[model samples]
Target chain A: MAQKQINGTTIDVNDEGYMTNHSQWNKVIAATIAEEEGITLTPAHWRVLDFIDHDFQEKGVVPGMRRMNKVGGIPTKDLYELFPNGPIKKAAKISGYPKPASCV
Target chain B: MTGSQPISKVSIVVSRGSLEGIYPGLIMANGARMEGIEANLFFTFFGLYGVLKNYNDKIRVATVGNPAMRVPSAKGLPMPTLLGAIPGMSAIATWMMNKEMEKIDIPPIPEFLEMIHDAGAGIYACKATVDMFHLTKDDFIPQMDKVLTVGEFYEQSAGGQIIFT
Candidate 1:
C-alpha cells in the first residue's frame, strides 16, 4: 500500500497506482493522475473513464478488454493509442478501480 | 540484458495445435500485454495452426486421451476416454468449449489473436515448421510478425521469461 497526494488531498493507492478508495476519486484527481502518466485528459479519455466508472458501479467488476471494445464502443486500436503502456490495465488504474483480476 | 534488470518481456511458445493447448498461450500472452509487459508468441509445430490464416478458424479440441475433458453440465463426472474416441465426440467437446468460453466473453481463436496483436503483442511462426509444412508468408494471419528459427526466437527472448504451452 502506498499513498499519493492528488490535488492537495492524500489518498491510498495500490502498488500500481490504482486508487484503493473509489470515494476518493474526483475529476481533479483523474486529471492529475493522467498528467503523471504523461497524458493530457481529452474527451476521448473521459469517455473511457466514464464508461469504466459506470460499468464498475453496475457490475462490481472491471470489464474485460473485449467488453470495453464491444460494449464501451472503443476499438482496440484506439484503446492502445489512448493508453499506450497497457490499455485495459492503465484505464482501470486511471479510472480509480482495482487492477482487473483477469489481467496478468 | 543484465540479470538485475527487471523482467519486462515474455516469450510464449505454443507447440500444441488443439484448441485446449492453444488457448493457454493466447490467454497468457494477452494477460502479459495487459500487464504492460512486452509479449511475444512463437507458434511452432502443431501450434502453427493457431497462426495459419486458414486453419486458425477450424482448429478442434483433441478429445481422445484428454483426461481433463469434462462434460460441461456434469460437474463431478469426467468424460470417459472411450467416449472421446467415438466419432463426433471431438466436435461435441469443441462445441462445449466454445459455449463455455462464450459465456465468459472469450473470443474465438482468430478474434483472440487479432485482439492480442492489437494490444501490442508480437505473433510469430516457427521457420522450421513453416518450411516443413510448405507454408509461405501469405499463409499466416496478417498479424503474423515473422517466421523465425528457434535460435532467432531465443535471441529475441534474451533476458525474458520463456513460457511453454
Candidate 2:
C-alpha cells in the first residue's frame, strides 16, 4: 500500500495502483489515475463507471467482465473499446475498486 | 501497471473431447483476454467436438477409465469402475459438474464460447482434424474464426506462449 496525492487530495493506493479506500475516490482522482493509464475519460467511459458503481452498490462485489456484459448491459467488445487494453483492470483502477476476479 | 509485460499472448491447444478436457483451454483463453492478453484456441483431434454445433453441448464428463472417479462424501471410496461404465454415469457426473460451475458463475459450453469470443479471443478449428473427421465449417459454431492448417496455426501464434490441455 502507498499514499498518492491526486488533484491535491491524498488517496491510498495498492501495489498495482488501485485505490485501497473507496471513500477517497472522486471524479478528479479517477480521471487522474486514468490519465496515468493513457485514457481520456469520455461520456462512454463515465457511463461504464457509473454502471459499475451502481452494480457494486446492489451486488456488493466488483462486477467482473461477465457481469458487466450480462447484468450491467455493457457488451465486452464495447467495454474493451471504452477502456482499451485490459478493460476490466483499467476500469477498476479508474473506478477506485479492487480488480474483479473472474475467468468467464 | 507493471514496468513490462511478460505474457502478451497465449496459444492454447485442446485435444480432448471430454467436458473436463475442453474447459481448461476455454477458461485459460477467457482468462487471457480478461487480462488484456491476446489469446487463440486451437481445437484439434477430438477437441473439434467442442466447437461443433451439434456436438458441443452433447459432450460429457469422461468417467470410464478415469482413475479420479471417486465418491466425495464417502471419502476415498472408488466409485466402482463398473458403476462408472454404466450407461448414464458420465451424464450424471457432467450434470453435477455443470451445477457446481454455475454456482461459481461459469457459463455453459456455448455461452462460454460467446463470452470468450466477445472478449476478443480467437477461436479456431484445426484443418487436419477437420479433414480426418470429414467435418466442414458449417459444422462449427459461429464464434469460430476459421479453420487453420498446422503451419498456419503456428504462423498465427507466432510470439505467443503455447499450452496444451
Candidate 3:
C-alpha cells in the first residue's frame, strides 16, 4: 500500500478505515487480551480490533500502556521492549487515540 | 478528521514523581469525561499512593528530585518528605494546587475522581505497587474499581492505547 506523510504522522486509510501504522501493536495487544479472557478469534487482527472496541465501550477512550498492560497481561516495564518507539505513543496511535496536546 | 465521531475513549498511566504525577492522570481522566470521552486511570509505583484511600489525602508534593521544581515555580521549595513531617504542609500544598487548578477551573482530586467515575472511567490500584508499599486493598480510596497487577491491567487495556503519566 502507498503511504503519505501528514504533519509528520503517517496517514493510511484503507477500505475498512483502519490506520496501518497502528495495526501491528494493536494486534499484539488484542491477542494478548483475548487469550487472557478465554476468547478466541480466527483472524489474528480481530483480537486487537475487538479489544480496543470493547475497552472504548467500557471507558469511552483508548487506554494507555499501563492500562493495556493491565488488560493484556503485559508488563509495564516490558512496554519499551514491545514497542521500540515508546509504548504509550505508539500503541495509542494504533488504538485510535490522538496524543493529548499537553503531552506535546 | 475521523468523520465528527466524538473522542469516545482515553487511557492514562500514572507512575512517577509524586502527587503532581498522580494528579495529572486523575485530572485527564476527568477532563476526558467532560469532553464526552470515557477515561481510565492506571496507577502504579509512586502513583499508586494517590488512589490509596489512606494515602490519598496524605500525598505530599515531592520537593526533591523533581524536574518540575528545577524551574521557576519550584525555586527554594522545601523538602516534601521533610515538610510532610512538619504540620500543615499537606494542607498548604493542597491549597496551592487547588488554587492553581481553580484558576483554570479544574476541580480538586476528590471531585475529579467523582466526575471520572460518574463518566464510567475506571480507576485501579497497581497490585505490585500496593504490595511494595505493604498496603492492602483497604488502603485505597473508594473510587478504585479493583487492585490489579500489571498483567491484569494489560488485559483490561488490551487494544486501547496505554499511556504512562
Candidate 4:
C-alpha cells in the first residue's frame, strides 16, 4: 500500500497507483488521476465511471469489460476510445476502485 | 522489477484448432490488449479454424490420442485413450469445457475474437493456409483484419515477444 497526493489530499493507493480507499474519492480526485493517465474527464467518461459506481455498489466487485459493455450500455469500442490504452484498468483507477481481477 | 522494461508488445501465433489449443493463445492475446500491450493474432494451418467462418463452431476438443484427456465430472480422473476414441467423445469434451468456462462468464470463441478485436488486437489469418484450403477472404469472420504471409507476420511481430502454440 502507498499514499498518494491527489487534488491536495493524501489517499491510499496500491503499487499501481490505483486508489485503495473508495471513501477518500471525489470528482476532483478522479479528474486528477485521469489527468495523470493523459485523459481529461468528459461526460462520456463520467458515464462509464457512473456505470462502475452502480455496479460496484451492488456487486462489491468491479465489473469486467465484457459486463461493462453488455450490461453497462457502453460498447467496447467506445470504452476503448474514451479511456484509450488499458481502458478497464485506467477507468477503474480513475473511478477510485481497486484494480480489476478479471483476465478478460 | 524484473530488470527489463514492462512488455509493450506481443505477437501470438496459434496453429491449433482444438478447443484446448486455441483458447490459450486467444486468452494471451486478449490479455495483452487488456494490459495496453500492442497485440495481434496470427493463425496458420489448423489454427485458421478459429478465424475461419465455416469452422469456428466446429472447433472441438480432441479426445483421441490426447494424453491429458480426463473425465471432468470425476475430478480430473484420466480417461483411457481407447475410451476417448468413442464416437462423440470429442464433442462431449468440448461441451463440458464450454460449460466450465461459461461459469466464469467467458464468451464463445467467435464472440471472444470480436472482443479481442475491439480491444485493438489485430486478428490475422495465414495466407498460405488460406490458399491451401482455397479459402477466400469472404470465408472468415468480418473481424479478421487481413490474410498475412509468414513474412508479414514476422514483420508485424518484430520488436516484441512472439509466442507460438
Question: Tell me, what's the RMSD of every candidate?
Answer: 2.4, 2.6, 14.4, 1.8
Chain A (alone) TM-scores for all candidate structures: 0.92, 0.93, 0.41, 0.96
lDDT of candidate 4 over A6-86, digit per residue (tens): 657999998899888899999999999999999999999999999999999999988887788788989888888999878
TM-score of 2: 0.93
Error of 2 at A24 (Å): 0.5
Against the true structure, candidate 4 has what lDDT? 0.90
- How far residue B88's Cα lies from its native spot in candidate 3, in Å, is 7.9
Give me the candidate number with maximum lDDT.
4
Backbone clashes counted, model 2: 0
* TM-score of B-chain for each predicted structure, in order: 0.92, 0.93, 0.75, 0.95
Candidate with more favorable, higher TM-score: 1 or 3 = 1
lDDT of 3 by residue, B1-165 (tens): 467765566678889637687777877775565444556798888777667665566566655454344322456544545445466655576667667665544555655565456456799888887887898877777878998877888888865667779
Q: What ranges in model 1 sit over 4 Å off?
A: A1-4, A10-16, B1-6, B72-74
Q: Which candidate, 1 or 2, has the higher TM-score?
A: 2
lDDT of 1 at A101: 82
Best by DockQ: 4
> What is candidate 2's lDDT per residue for B116-141, written digit by digit as tens?
89888899999999999998889999
Docking class of 1: medium
Q: Rank the candidates by DockQ, best first.
A: 4, 2, 1, 3
Please write out the lDDT profile of model 4 over residues B35-63, one tens digit for every residue: 88999899999999999886797789898
Superposition error at B73 for model 2 (Å): 6.0
